[model samples]
Target: MTNDFSPLSQWQLDRARRTVHRGGVIAYPTEGVWGLGCDPWNPDAVEEILELKQRPAHKGLILVAASTDQIEFLLAPLDPEMRERATRHWPGPVTCLLPDPEDRVPFLVKGDHSAIAVRVSDHPVVKALCEAAGQPLVSTSCNPAGRPPARHGWQVRRYFGQGQVHIVPGALGGNRKPSRILDIVTGQWLR
Candidate 1:
């Protein structure tokens, strides 16, 4: 399948933001592959992503933000050392599991976990989308459970079908692997 959603333009970004604001899901380029995203605060939107990917709710989802400020609530509780360790790899392909005090993240996004997985994206499209959305977004690989993540827009459409998700056209970053997951408290690599 061929994709019309390439070389992301400002108009496409606006459309994607509108779709997200209306509680719709979208597919956009990430550091390594296409990712499905939605407003993290919207349960319906999050559920749509899970349904489209056939992902179990217990697995949770990763949240991507444009800047650390967008997720300060989740990061504020960490001590200085843990906070530094958690944020040392920001704006890159690294996801950190941090303690969620006050539980600002919804249970669906956090799943059954006490910590939330988050990343401050360095990819321009992802950063712009999060900035346009004005908050963190729920991000998961753009494919069903057990399937390889979509590497291109057409693959995203083939997996979820056109019109099911707003396709935000862009190129993946240079990373060849998904973001490495690290637990801030244990200094362990979860991925």
Candidate 2:
């Protein structure tokens, strides 16, 4: 698949955004694996992804963004030191669990926890998709629970099928493992 954000890439990004806006799930490349994304605010879409993965709602999900600005609403309540510590590892492979004081994030995305897992991605396709979507997306590995994450386009298709998800054409970032998960408040690693 294409790497750079060319015109065709932009077109695909636009289409992906449209699909997410319409409450559709999409599969795209992320730092280490293929990720399934949809509007985090849409309960139906989030439920669809959960059902597709055979994952329970209490496990929660990660929200991927193009930049910290896109998720400032979720980060604004944290202490400056905590915020800095969390964001410092961003634009890369690190997902930080930030506290949501006002309940801005829906329960379906945050699951049974009070904190929301989020990441600012450096992958071009992920960044482009988040930018086009105009918000953080519900990003989780594109594979059913108890299975390995998809590292190839074919694997993504095989896991989700052709019409089940809108596959955004791209290549995975050069990372062997998925993003490390950290809880900023306690400074503990979750993954």
Best by lDDT: 2
lDDT of 2 by residue, 14-52 (tens): 889899999999998888889999999999999999999
| Model 1 lDDT tens row, 86-109 | 788997889999888788899989
Given candidate 2, what's the lDDT at residue 134?
Answer: 95
Please list all clashing residue pairs in model 1, or write none if there are none.
Answer: none
Report backbone clashes per prediction.
0, 0
Q: What's the distance in Å from true for residue 26, model 2?
A: 0.4
Residue 50 Cα positional deviation in candidate 2, in Å, after optimal superposition: 0.3
TM-score of 1: 0.94
Clashes of 1: 0
Considering summed lDDT, which 10 consecutive residues are worst modelled in model 2? 1-10
